[model samples]
Target: MDIKSFIDSTYLKTAAQAGLDENQNQEVLKTFVNEAIQEGFKLIMIRPEMVSLARKIVLDTSAKLLIGTVIDFPSGNSTIETKLNEASQAITEGADELDFVCNYEAFINGEIDLVKSEILKGTQLALANNKIIKWIIEVAALTDQQIIQLSALIKNVVLTHFSEADYNAVFVKSSTGFYKTANNEPNGATIQSIIMMLENASPLPVKAAGGVRTYEDAVAMIQLGVKRIGTSSAKEIVHRRHNQNEY
Candidate 1:
């Protein structure tokens, strides 16, 4: 596949009700998508609120639009019913694909039943609309043991979600980009561990976000078996390789 098709570079804004209220969030997001497309990047990720607007804007363009509604965003504290309801609503709003941040607290606290149910419902909802499901398992909070354990369960989960023949596009994502710094990002080790886990998990793809802000970073994740990178710095990476004089 083309590299463009394999990357979901820009992901969603945190839910406003969830406390991330950037006044310029919408414009920043729109410009990010537009720039990504202009620079030949494909598959711009959009929030639930901006999904329809994204789809509308990119309808005439070749760039593929992907809508990512965080299930239990930032903190995976929402009840299973709320996550399911969110999934259904996002799909109804015209999402080409669904990236769900699976319930992390459940995983950490050994509430595997809760974890499984949320994933099952979300995947089912995503499939009901014929949308692709991308599961985000926040990697930073996990230890090596947890990572491996999650991957083992994800193996079974993916099998249940997609048959061997239908597993072509399943994605196991690394982070949600919740942590940041003044100069850079974090989570390379986390991403690497996730990739290693996925190697054992199944044939499903893996996506690495958070801290992947450069071409070298993108290439490193891709080398480690990440099929995608979810970052807001995609344009900067593209710029590093381009010269204005050449254009």
Candidate 2:
């Protein structure tokens, strides 16, 4: 199934989040970037601060690994200006793709104009820079109806303002893999959520992130029409697929 091509090998934890000192955290990031290169994953998704290092490592190797960084991160409540500035910095530092956390909270609060404006501006900046972009909707934070509406909203914004060719460059991604829910409920991508996104965000691809832990889970997402799967378990999933084939 060429599962490796569908994987966005991800590591977005900060020093304190991972319980490591700054230097040790960076060392871990270096190893993560090297592993993605050796494993031939489609892209390496990291925090914006590490884009320069990842770019340098990829340039040193002959590997075609792409570097992607998040904008506005787990919280999508940042002002539009803040989001744009973060995105611009990431691009200047050599990120091939930018995944922006959509203002899902605003949308949930009925602030449609704010959400729409950010999507329009964010998508515009990304396309103008010739970099692929994805909007993380944080499905776990929304209800079923909100998911459908938000997906359609993003698709509408892109389709209305951008040309047909630019559609592929904009994606409606599922989650950030970092949301905290009450009682530790599943706060990432789920089958039902993905199905809703795929059906409404069509034309604009969907990326299933968070909670995709196994070869079977990844395959399920792909089969359901997702173009990418973001996970920290990329190596384990690939190895599981190989082990299954051997048996």
Candidate 3:
């Protein structure tokens, strides 16, 4: 299935969040970048603050890996201006792709216009700079209806305002991997949610993020038409693929 191309090897946690000091986090990020280069993964998704660091690590290497960063991270509650500013800075720091957390809370509160405006502006900003845009829907935090509605809304905005060719550069991603849920509910990409996204957001690609930790799960998502899979288990998955091929 060419798992490396489908995978976005990720490490989005900051030093404090990961229970490590600053130097430790830098080391961890270096490891992620090196592993991606060696394994031939499609991209390395890290915090916006680490874009420049990652870019430097890959500069002298022969790997064709791209660098990506998240905006308004785990939560999509940030203002549109804030997200645009974050995206702009990331691009300046050498990020090839930007993953913006969609304003799901606004959408749930019947603020559809605000949600649409945010994505529209964010998409425009990315396109203007020749960077890929990924709108994280945080599907695990939503209901089935919300999933369908949100996917359609993103597709509508892209199709209505942008040319058809630009569709390839934009994507509706599944999750931010940090949404809190009551009763310990799931908080990442689920097969059910991914299917809903693929069905409603056609022509535009779909990226299943969060909780895709195994080779089998990743294969399933790709078979279902998902264009990308975001996870931290890229090495393990690729290793498993290699084992199967050897046998």
Kindly give the number of clashing pairs for every candidate.
0, 0, 0
TM-score of every candidate relative to the true structure? 0.83, 0.98, 0.98
lDDT of candidates 1 onward, in order: 0.68, 0.95, 0.92
Tens digit of per-residue lDDT, candidate 2, span 1-247: 8999899999999999999998999999999999988887889999999999889888888779999999999998999999999999999999999999999999999999999999999999998999999999999999999999999999999999999999989999999999999998898999999999999999999999999999999999999999999999999999999999998
Those runs of model 3 whose alpha carbons end farther than 4 Å from true positions after fitting are: none
The digit string of per-residue lDDT tens for model 1 on 1-247 reads: 2445556667555546335456566666667667766767656776777777677667767465555555556566689788777777777776677777778768999999888877777776777677777777777777778877776676677687666765655677777777433455454335557566667566777777777777677677777777677777777766654543256
Candidate with more favorable, higher TM-score: 1 or 2: 2
lDDT by residue for model 3 (1-247), tens: 6788888999988899899999999999998899888877789999998999999988878578899999999888999999999999999999999999999999999999999999899999999999999999999878999999999999999999999989999999999988887898888999899999999999899999988999998999999999999998889989999999999
Q: Tell me how many residue pairs clash in candidate 2.
A: 0
Q: What is the lDDT of residue 126 in candidate 1?
A: 72
Each candidate's root-mean-square deviation in Å? Answer: 3.7, 0.8, 1.0
Candidate 1 residue-wise lDDT at 158: 69
RMSD of 3: 1.0
**Ten contiguous residues minimizing lDDT sum, candidate 1:** 180-189
Clashing pairs in 3: none
The candidate with the higher lDDT, 1 or 3, is 3
lDDT of 1 at 105: 69
Model 1 TM-score on a 0 to 1 scale: 0.83
